[model samples]
Target: MQLSENLSPPEGETIDPTSRLLAASERLMAEAARRFPIAGDPHSRAYWMEAMINQAPDYFFFKDRDSRFLLANRAVISDLYKETDLTGRTDFDLFPPELAQQFFEIEQEIMRSGEPMLDMEEKIPDGRGGLKCLLTSKLPMRNEQGEIVGIIGVARDITERKRQEQLHLGQAELLKMIAVGAPLKDVFTALIHLIEGQIADVTGSVLLLDPEENCLRHVAAPNLDPNCFTRIDGIPIGPAVGSCGTAMWRGEPVFVADIETDPLWEGYRDLAVPYGFRSCWSAPIHSYQGQVLGSLGLYGRTPGLPSTTCQKLLGMATHIAGIAIERKQAEDRIQFVAHHDVLTGLPNRSMLDERISSAIEAADDANGTIAVAFIDLDNFKLVNDSLGHHAGDELLKTVSRRMLDKLRPEDSLVRLGGDEFVVLLTGPRRRGEQLSVRLESIRKAIADPVLLEGHSVQVTCSMGVALYPGHGRNATELLANADLAMYRSKEIGRDALQFFTAEMASSAHEKLRYQEELRRAIAREEFVLHYQPQMDLKTGHIFAVEALIRWNHPERGLLMPGDFISFAEDTGLIGQIGDWTLRAACRQNKAWRDAGLPPVVVSVNVSARQFQEPEWVERVASALRKSGLEARYLELELTESVIMADVQQAVALMHRLEALGVHLAIDDFGTGYSSLSALKRFPVDRLKIDRSFVQDLPDDPDDAAIARAIISLAHTLQLKVIAEGVETREQLEFLRGAGCDEIQGYYLSKPVRAEGIETLLRIPNI
Candidate 1:
């Protein structure tokens, strides 16, 4: 029978035939008839209807002809957790504006047609994520006179059932990862993500118990702050520890309703508050034998016990975590050997790559930088040769321990192979000076003595540093650059740290190519010498000339010493090049004398490498003998650094040159650390004051004083003091007044080719 046909009708008014009482218990139907007053007597009907629906769990409401809420139940008024009465209010007050308009139109249709609406599925916010399904039924309600007055509606919640279906489907997909033997970390990551998706306002994490360290280490926490994860990791399990730690320590599930005020959560309240986590529940993960392996925790933004759905899914995650944890523990020993160094117990290259990639991503997201340091022990091969392999192994272990002690707990040290390691400094790396300070500490730690086989062996390491996003965007480029820099440190001298730069990376290859080209230049004669005449004071005459080498590149024009000399010195090519220069300059001087030109001594500069050779004196004698130029017509000049380095050696070399009747002079004299006592013993005849002291001339008092001191010292020693780089009359007059024996600078003439020197030799002197 229809809803109005079974109910009584009033005498003066007919029932609204389209209106009907909805299906309910027999008692409810009778109560509705009395409350609706089918008999047209309605003193207590309104009160009964409001009181009844208020106790109903489902949403119930009645609206007037204008779509205003004439009455509402506890469920309707309590939406979004608001407790105010909704009487005489419109749907605009209870729902969003657009939703209210649509609801009004639907209710108006039912009221005008006087028809009952069966079950209609609608979705709305369950006051959480705004996505809950409900079954709504709308119908017209008549008054005691049987006249249609307004519309009444009832809604039943189906959110929990729908969420349950999604949860089960998601869990099924997550199980496949574990079935295929995915990595423990990957599986845990998937499991936590699935639980978070089904549960509203909650994030999940998985932690594994490291029995050796007696702490809980984070396995997966996709939503947690990375820095927070790092801080929370390695938390020890004990009484009143964090939720996860305490749960594992007690061997049971633990729930913290409010992190801010809960005594059990007091330890981590500060850490959780900043991340917007106010509630937490953790379940202990257990193996099949009932031994606790780890914990599965769920954290929510608001403080309270978790929902039924969150609690249920947390238990499911705990089971999955247990399976993976047990499997990983069983395979830990084999896996550790595969990923870590066998001798030093440090992470191997494969694990280093994994960790570096993760660190790089985190750093990029944080807008920070990380330094990858490649370290190699110096003379490590020597240890293996002199002491047995066992002794070398012991030394490696000792060095590894020392280096590890010098790093932060978050930093990773990986042994890439024998005598080589990489350190991932997972801290702020914006400043190079800060990294340099840290690297210095590590270097000093590695330099400490290591006792091996009853012998104390002092070891040192060379390290190269590369930064992320500056040196490289990824691990491979970073590692390659760092390795190149380390080799550069070894090239210059070992036992120091070098930060990687783009220039350092190309220097080695460029220098090698340059050395080869220099060798070819020696064979093919691409080098040409320019002569700068040294004037004799008190006489308009050119007494000597300094031969400067220049390179004529086939593509680029003339190249100066600043372009390739340092590379030549570093590669030991300067020795051969300097020898060639000496012989060439001697022959040119002899050619001038033979050509009926005034005889003049030509000085050739000596490099540190050429000066250290045992046959240096013999090489000089051969150059003069081959050219048939008398020794007095040739001068050999050494920079102050080369001469002052070994004072005794300098005196002997100078004495030998003097005994051969060849002139000797110190080039760039004032720039070096030369002692006055030592200078007196040297058999030098001339001191070429450095251009740095003469460029400013009399204007710069410091330079003037230095020039004066050198001139005075040279005169006291009975040696000639030649001031170079003089470019003005004031400078020339100043030097002449100070008793400078000679002047060689632009004030006379710029350095020129031998042809130009012909004119300069005939020109007026300063």
Candidate 2:
């Protein structure tokens, strides 16, 4: 009530009115001034105090000694929406025990000492969300007897200022780390820790964008539920992807609160729900020139947008991250170019040399040997000149892949520029022959034909080997010796391999002369065919003849196949010679039939190299058509050793021959290893037992047993078996009793010229 209205004299005093009013107002105003001192009327102290408390920016509350609230200002009532009552409510009633205990202790101290606790920096709740940086002060509320009754604590909101300062400090430290060339992951780790410390109820992460995979890879994400990170490690970047991927895809920041309902978290809501994170925000890390490198993601358990401080921190971190990632990628590119071959991705000469040096030291320490092979592609220039350089490049790439596939994981094949490469074999010692076998496998792999530009281009490499301590004491010496050996291979003929030896250099001239003579022999057409007759044991009649090749050197008189066949194979001339032999044999057999000789099957030997040709079957068909001879009259004999190497291809080829009605025979059967199961797949008409089994057969039980088993096995398969080198009547009788179908050796006739075979064929049972 207004004092002026309440102070009227009862029933209107009859005395002087002005004097009476002056005395009454002076007395009431003096008592009001004692309680409230303001610029306005002194009697309205309660209104002034109430206005001040409600208008104050900071929270003002008074609590009793037991921390029970006695009075709260307007800010306290509005901020702590549910804590309105002042009669019975205490700090424990509003806050958790741990938080209320802190308040209780401060209030107790203030009341006991009758002093004020001022400007205490504390992390307290702002009554709305998360923790706040608060500068709280508590003062004792005392009565007139000097007994403390209650306490008042005022807390000013300083959350933004405190967090902003912390963010700035963290940014400086992180930048310093990046400037000092910290590893990308390490810098990311530091940034994660900085964010987790400054931002309340949040986790930090740095996800790198993989350009190749077009996804975000989790680089670092500490202080988070592992599922939120580990489960989404490589998320594809797209519109519907999670925060990190979406941010990178859009090249901007993405903020998602209430993840369950956000469209951006359509498929990923379950991932955050289980981990207790309800919100996610991501900002793309861009290169200085604006390329999206990766992203920085922040996740929080509370559903809300990022605070102002967090937003500022993410911006700076992404900028710094871009610079670091770019620097790292550039360094990696330089390192890769220096160490690897651009064409094959194999080690280059520099890396190979380094490895060789390290290998040498290790080998010397263990007193072991290391084989270093230098490989050079033969006739590579011809391929480049005839089929464009592009085709040549394709051929090289195919060969590189093949040779690489054949190497052991520990072995390294290094490109030494152009058509040359070096291979290093280290670790446990291997025999010289084993190393030779490995190198041979690589050469054979390279020899497979590669189809490029409609032409099947086949390549063969010449590999020269030099062993550590035996051929050279160092890498340079070893390489030089290997080069010398490679040159020796070229001097002998291309597509040949040799080991380093001092004597090879002196023999090189002699090898060159021999190569020249051999080349001339092929050009001069000085080769002849000899035929050996095989008589049927059941009828004692000659029905087949094996054609043998012999070289008639102009000055050397006559030369056996042993004298020139190896050289021919080494020079890659065996394919041509094999084709020639087939044509000659066909024509000769046809002529013999035209001459009224007894018809017989003409068998020709096919070498390993010739049989592997892509057109081998076509060549056979062409020969039959050209000579006008039936395929049934001709039999192609292949050694067991060659056919067994690649059983599948051999089976297919033999089946093709069967389709052509050409009889196929397995020659030297007892001398090779053939699995019974695989041998059954071959569509062969006969198995010619190698002569070695028959030469001393009847007397030697091992040979007799071998020959008997072969004949019995052939009969079981419904195949005819022939025993060669049956020079004696005893051997012939033994083979016949063993169920052999035929015999071919001196007992019948030696390998003679076609005319000589025709004479024997017309002699009936002779």
Candidate 3:
């Protein structure tokens, strides 16, 4: 049969056309081949087939029923044997012994099961010296009778895909650990292991930066000698330093692929060579604000560049380090503010209170004693008033510093408030004198002058020392007793120190009781007013009566002013008692007026407390109105102390009271602290010479001269003069000869009730 005739086209009308001729020729060949078979030489047929298969680009091969290669294309032959004969050779015979064995086992499995194996990984020899990883597929071949005869396989290289798959798996494991929120150390360790396991010949470390120490500390490392990493724990960051140090110093990533040759590691080469690390890559751990916090690094025994994945892992570690550093710093700041004072930078009141409480508990536990010394600076107000508050504040701050320096380190100094401080000393009473000496030293230290604004200002402090289990056993009692002692020190002339005593407590209790009794005495009408007639010395006529306070006690018949007046003044009870005296004296004088007795003026002494009351004027006016007495006949006697308390307020109050038609007299005029300036400023109608001046008037020349001078001064000021405590006739004669306006004393008559005064008034003149 003719090949061209058998390939002839089907019947066509136009046989002359080239297309029709070619088609007819093909159809004739096809008919001939179908009707008859042609015999050919084996070598020619094989040569033609081999040429056709070898011309293909893909690897092609045929295997016998026994799973041995019968024929392989040129591409396969070249891939498997480097252009050498691979036909009629099994995979085991063509490749390295082990790899070839694996391929044959796979082929045998495919043939025995009559199943095709697709995309199987196989290693083929490159014929140079190494092997190539490839993807091969084996398919079952069948004869015309549909029986499996051999296997046909095709292969394509997939070494790159397999490498990518392994890399992906390692990255997935790392990401899974990160996503689980593992501890920082564990995460870092896992990362190191991942790099050393998947990547080639690598060692790595993490270093945390210590800002206070100005150094980097190794925190984690894998595949490195412990001693090598430990020695690098506290390395200072600088230029031309090792890889981690340099990265931290520049706040950037540093790569040294050849550690032995890199200048950055010149001084640190010994550390690398012994541990077999030839390359290192370091990335600085930095905060969001761009502050370098730490570094993450990779070390390799061989010279190599870091993969992009490794750099990305380092960046993640840097972020975690930054967060940790910020959190730790924030916690430190919170703790500092909690325990420190903002203004003075000293331990604040909270710290003081805690220390005191602990000391108290300790003292109680050990049966030991603790002393709390309460100190108040004397004359602090004068400094504030004269020099200004700024100077006063400076003085206080200086004093605080000095006091702290004077105390023992174990002792505590606390500022209670303005001009007040407390010092706490805790220990056993092993040396009483030693403690006293220490305290005296402290007092002297504080008493030293402080220079402020180029002025040497001397400040002295009064201390009140209270001991635990002696003055008080608790904090409140100790503070109270200390405060009480401090007041006592002030009363006894400040710039002194006093220990809490039982006598002070007793006296305080008595004063408190007296105050309560005085309040009740005013309300219960137990208080009475006595009248002592004030006679006109020249006319010998009773012109007025001075009212005196007398306590008509239920137990003790009649109590003089000497018994309770001082106590009343001290407890601030004098105001209430004085108000009662004013009303009673006015009412009694009105009673006498109604009874046809002389309409003489009634002088009632006003206490300092009463005079200082804001409503003193109103009180006086109300008293006169209620008694129906004319204000002109009422005389209000003010002591020198009353006007001196607040001179301006006193002058204003006196003027207001005087404006109500009441006469104001300065009682005890020459015996008080009133300045001559204040005397002229006061609005008074008369000056009453104090009894001290008149008691020795006739005997003592000084007393007589003082009385005369007072009378002369009163006349010069256009004010009348009255001499009180005129007990002797000679004293009375002296005062009269001195031209004193009025006289009132025991000689005329002691202070008696209103009815008794009428009897004395009715007596005829001698």
User: For residues 411-469, what per-residue lDDT tens digits would candidate 2 score against the true structure?
Assistant: 78998878999988888844555777877888889898889899988888788889998
lDDT of 1 by residue, 1-766 (tens): 3544455666786655344333223446566666555443233455556666767889887788888777778886676336487677886865688977888888888988989887888876555547768889999999999889998888888878777787777677665554444688888888887887787688888888888998988888988888888988888888788788899999998999888888887767776889899899999999978988889988889888877866777788888778666544533433454467657889887577779999998998889889899999999999999998889989999989988998888899999888999988986644455778888899899999988998999989999999888998899778888998898789889998889887876755865777788778778878889999888887958898889999886667788978878868867788888988999898888888887787788988999998888788898999888999999988888886788778788788778878888988888875554544466677778999888678878877756766776676567568898888989999998998888989898877777898887776656553
Compose the digit string of candidate 3's lDDT tens values, residues 1-766.
Answer: 4556534456773344677666655565455445653443323445445656777867888989776678788887776567577656776666668866777787778778989998888766667675567888898898999788899988876766765676567566655444333455666676666555555566777788889998978777866789998888877889877899999999899999899899999888987888778999988888768988788788887886788876776675567556545444433333333344323445544456577777889898998878888889999998889888779878878888887887777788877657888888986655445666666777888889888778888988898988888898777678778888888889999888889998778766766877787778888989878788888877788888888888988777888999999888867778888888899888888988889876789988888778777888898999999999999999988887668778888888988987899999988776555654346677888998888667757876656756776676567557899888889889888888888998888898887887888887777552
Quality of model 1 by C-alpha lDDT: 0.80
Question: For model 3, what is the alpha-carbon lDDT of residue 638?
Answer: 82
Ranking by lDDT: 2, 1, 3
List CA RMSD, all candidates. 30.7, 32.6, 33.7
Instruction: Show model 2 residue runs off by greater than 4 Å.
Output: 1-162, 210-216, 234-239, 248-252, 263-267, 286-293, 307-313, 357-368, 377-396, 427-433, 444-462, 473-477, 487-494, 503-766
| Candidate 1 residue-wise lDDT at 196 | 77
| Candidate 2 local lDDT, residue 177 | 61
Question: Whole-model Cα lDDT per candidate?
Answer: 0.80, 0.82, 0.77
Question: What's the CA error at residue 464 for candidate 2, in Å?
Answer: 3.0
**Which candidate has the highest TM-score of all?**
2
Per-candidate TM-scores read 0.37, 0.46, 0.38
Candidate number with the higher TM-score (2 or 3): 2
